[model samples]
Target: MPRNAAQTEIYDALGVGFGPSNLALAIALSEQPERLRTRYLERTRQFGWHRDMLIDDATMQVSFLKDLVTPRNPVSRHSFVAYLHQARRFHSFVNQKTLFPTRIEFHKYLEWAASDFEHLVRYGQTVTEIGAWQDQGAVTAWAVTATGPDGELSTTLTRNLVVATGLTPSLPAGVRTSRRIWHSSSFLSNLRDWQPPDRPRIAVIGAGQSAAEITAHLYKQHEAAEIYSVYSRYGYTQSDDSPYANQVFDPQAVDDFYYADQQTKQSLYRYHANTNYSAVDQDLIEELYRRQYSDTVSGRERLRVVNLAKISQVREIGDKVRIELSSPHLDGPLDVDLAIFATGYRPMDTDGILAPVLSHCDLGEDGRPLIGRDYRIATRPHVTAAIYLQGGTEASHGISSSLLSNTATRAGEIADSLTRTGRAATTLPVSVPQE
Candidate 1:
């Protein structure tokens, strides 16, 4: 079917992804007395944040106070506390006396907040390209091209663009994902598609939170299955959620980190890596240890932790995966029904999507897009359109750049910047020129 020719509209801001970052921005935009013409496009059919990793018993790492708007505006109606009150769970939640909420409950809160601005978001629309709309040799607007689920093409013109596409799942250099091999990002979805054998053996690679969670999940789901956790670390390192260390996620920390030199930034990231990097929750670490000890006491060694080990090679045999383990202690190959690499993710690169507009944006010595303190892309002065990033600015920002801890505050900053720039001046819809 031919795509219906639709007229383009010049928006104050066009958000690329409707995830928590952009969702928070939407709420911030709504709080402004002078409304900005904004539209958010999401590839998924609906709002979901790490749906596949929403493990049943998994709880959030951050406190509930760091919700969609609390850190920015405590009185905002879109806050988690506000949502709980609206859902009649506020009193019950308080009784629990826990800082972190269950992942399922948190997801529900996000959905409830997102429901308020249904009109502002378009689902199942993947943004394929973002081109600059030049007028008199100066880039004045952005031509946002997106394709809907039904193969219908649409383009919108915006004076400002906010890219919050989030992170991409990353695997090791030599490892390739296949039917039997999986990444932790697709754990639940992939598990549903496969039937475990009578004595299934599974291997979870990496030492991050996801790897720990998946190992625990597999152990609980398949009672008879043997689970192998492979990592170079001796054991899972507990994440440092201490009060002082937690300050790295504060809004003020972003300012400090952004103003510091590149050497200082690298040192800061390395020093605070445990705050968000390859570390597991202390409670979870204890829980897994308890399970491991219990198995030893009962003389049933179903759970094996292959510490100080590296995967030399991974090959698919007839019906199973052969993972060659290389370590000073172990000597042979470990065959498993499935091998899961919970190796974490890399930031979303804007180079491919923003190919048309990259020339106008400044790059640092590292060849990364230069991001300002306001999270806006440092484009040439003539290119008036603002290009802000919600993620992928860890180098310029701080450890909290991709974390939910500073999401509310970050969005508020972007909203303030947009308002100051006065990009919302043109409120009328316009037609896009054919390429």
Candidate 2:
């Protein structure tokens, strides 16, 4: 670590978020022989990825082989198996013989990998603006502006900017979160130490894995409360995780998807949407079904499955939320003491920070940035600063853009691009101090 809080005159790469994607990039940069001055800014005071939803018994959707380092460098010490070995749990974990580990354990694995790059990370910094750095009538670097914990603004200069700010929580149109309503992103935290009344009616909206998991969790936690899982679909659709279908997430598939015609790309995304979007794991679906069946056998069922139903309107009436249903099975608006929306997440929008720099970027017909296979946004020829993305590239890349399935390999590719761009050389008017 540096003896003082000294920043290099210009960073070779400055990452916007300290999440898994950028964390993998940091590891890749470190492992390479070339020394690229890099730094990561995280809005959180400490490192955490979906901490609120790190359910104890919940397993990862992706295989453990797709860890932060394995997909890029299987022999890297930063691998999850390496962490398990160092933590003295490798043998025990092997005995379980499961490809997916608990979400809690996976989060710990991520934190373990992140611990190695503390010197290159500055927490509690939220990036606000990004712009081209103009000096001597030429653009040389990107000026990244961010706000500190105390609300003071600071700017950093870097030749390359990798934005991996992650996804945004999405809710249904016209629905807002309140005391009685909340999204699954805040699931565990919102229900911490809180208990519903006896025979309380609860409405869980959406048909994704989160919705099923939350339903199962609530059923186990509050035995007396009635868990009503309301969704537009008649039943939860199982995700397509077959080996053949899983090929869509392969590293090579990204290249194939990128080069394919627009019609082919749309067809592929539409056909494989069930693999991730609005789908639940097969085992979890069976578990929920079994619970509902067992409860039905007992004659007093607390787990209610309200299928083919949609909440047309949600109104907060004092202590309860009255949700108007559109299905034929409903007699009137169901009044529930609590309603949780497991509505998934939206892709990261670059418009916020990229406003000042958008003029240099080429936008697609949809007004989205035109990104290359390297994940670098296509910019005007004069703009030398490279802008790479770790998320929101499903249009050009594939479905794995914002997912952990390809993060490790994706980061390695981006790191390779950084090296090939001639930005890895720490050369400037002022010498960069060696570690």
Candidate 3:
């Protein structure tokens, strides 16, 4: 690649990240009749979606029909069924009679879909900055810079920008992770590297699906060890997947959510929080309870459910960590060999990347970026460069903003917006958008 951007090469759109959000956008762009030159930058060496947490038996919560393109264009070759058929497993999959496929299988389907756009993505390049591309006094495009594979800077210009950098792993305040401590995002990898002693003490914090899954996995893997499931709740809450309640993810619901007042939106979130929050599947909860009860019946209870508890403090003492566990049932602190936090993730803050160009964008009353119904950031009239968000729109777009449930439809909407914006500004500069 070149050190300096080619003066004549201005992309119609540039995607900052190549995760499922942008991947769906790529597919939509490619399938659209009016093509706009587009490229995606990803920091990873290859495409992967939650690689470390693809537990063998874990199935996707969302249905296979929600694959990258099926909801928007059922005939697309990138659909999950198409992948299964191309991989010669369609008949076998049909025999299973399940709407959700294994997470591993779905990830492979994503890779299969991604393979078609290998030529359009720049892997191992992390975006570092997005600045205004000015012509005279008008900000006409975005000047994007990224750290190349070898640490060199590669800059490019684009008329339209889509940021889908995804979320950041969240940890409670004052809690830090070490070799023995980990967040659920890298659970499998860390566990693989861990060499546990005989009858080790392991604690998993949080009451989410990840925490429950880790509890089950650890119980299975470490038969002789003590596995503690510590959480504030008295027991695990079952996720709400009932048919009527599931309408929260419908495309029309997004419109309802968007138009609702702020108070109504908050109420909606509170009402539907069980759908995708700190909850576990009912089947898994039953399985865990069965295991716990069986151990109790055998007089060899290795799995301990420390309910209504919170970890007050954690300190490393050589190989093991001393956890200051506070609970109504506990008499003292509990120490563990390893601790895993499945506290979930927070939306990635893009202030750093958008710093240079943010002043030109409008803000809501709460002082955050004011994103419109089309997912475009509200900007001043003089600014012609369009910027869109592919994730972190939950506050404005509803619960499915950052989920796979509405990814295909959302992508199609963004792609439609980009195409219309492109057609309206046909007089803008054009060249091959590449390094």
Candidate 4:
């Protein structure tokens, strides 16, 4: 194992998760080295985003223009087009005028972006906690705890922290992931461990893109397996991400959503949440519909979609799993062998890590972090340095907080804010030695 820390303290104005969001932040920081000290931490030993679902033909929901650094810095060398060129795919990409790239290709592009600033990122490191402190009336520093590859523990001190740790996959209330039951995030790996049964019956819960994709993937991979899909929606709804409506996800939308009244925010969420979250891609929806039709015409109706149903009980029964699904359409309950949940994920809380220094940070009535326009944490009167945020901005910044739409602009704006804040004065320096 390598050494966990160096002799000197490493002071960072920003620490990020090294994904596309933070990758954009890193790219911006690289351009303005004189103003920012940024470090990106990745738990995986490498950079990858949604690798498990890098299905063979799956394409990005959004256009390629919404890449890591294009909207804010189109001429950037770190742009997706630049990445494609580096990988020798630019010529082929131009031949196909489609702005949406395949999942596999996009994953490769992300890895390429991650490799550019290899020195600014620390792989095989997981941030375990974040603690804040006050110095001369403003939030000055944050102590970040991380575990190294060989289980060694270390802490890094920084003036600003951007938590882009990503979402936490959630299963139905009573269902838990096991060898038999799996979430879509771990679908590919788990499937590799099992030999296809002669007459396997797999139950996928959810009507969203992930759920539908899993249902389709399983149906195509397993010949004799009966795929049962359960969801509350009557049928999969195609996302309304058409040109006119997609502008709702623009960087300016964040400002509009943030300043709006409580009722307006809730109204916007109700109207547009499906654009990014609950709805399936239009092409995917049509493909699934076509497959269902083909199955019906052939009298092999193994691919089933049990709409408006909910999974009530899930239990692992030896090699096979049994699940009980409930719905208004069903008389009692439907049973299945294995259940795969494509429900979704929730945000991670930094509040516990911030507890020891809680008095330094402010909170809103909803118990969420009180975030400002530039995605800075509203600190208590006693704190001074800036505390940047890259996650959990949904409530304050709107739906695009966790999505890739506003990433380029958001990261640049945050970097600009950090530069404007200037150096913090302190009685003692709190920095993590260079690793």
Q: Please identify model 3 stretches exceeding 4 Å from their true place.
A: 1-8, 429-435
Q: lDDT tens digits, residues 364-428, model 2?
A: 89877899899999988766778999998998998999999999999999999997764533343
Query: lDDT tens string, model 1, 89-174?
Result: 99999999998999999999999999998999999999999988777777778889999999988887788999999999998888
| lDDT of each residue in 1-435, candidate 4, tens digit only | 115544534465646477888888888777765556667778887788988888778889878888888899899898889888877888989999898899888888888888888988899998777766433434557767888999988777676677777777887787778877889999888888976667988888888889888888887888898888788889999889887679788998998999999899999988898787778888888888898889999999888878887667778767777666677766665555677889988764566555566566687887665889999888776666557778778887898998888888998998777666634433345443356
- Pairs of residues clashing in candidate 2: none
How do these models rank on TM-score, best leading? 3, 1, 2, 4
Please, what is the TM-score per model? 0.96, 0.95, 0.96, 0.92
Q: Write the per-residue lDDT of candidate 3 for residues 9-34, one digit (tens) a residue.
A: 67889999999999999999999999
Q: 133 in model 3: Cα distance from truth in Å?
A: 1.1
- For model 4, the local distance difference test gives 0.78
lDDT of each: 0.89, 0.88, 0.89, 0.78
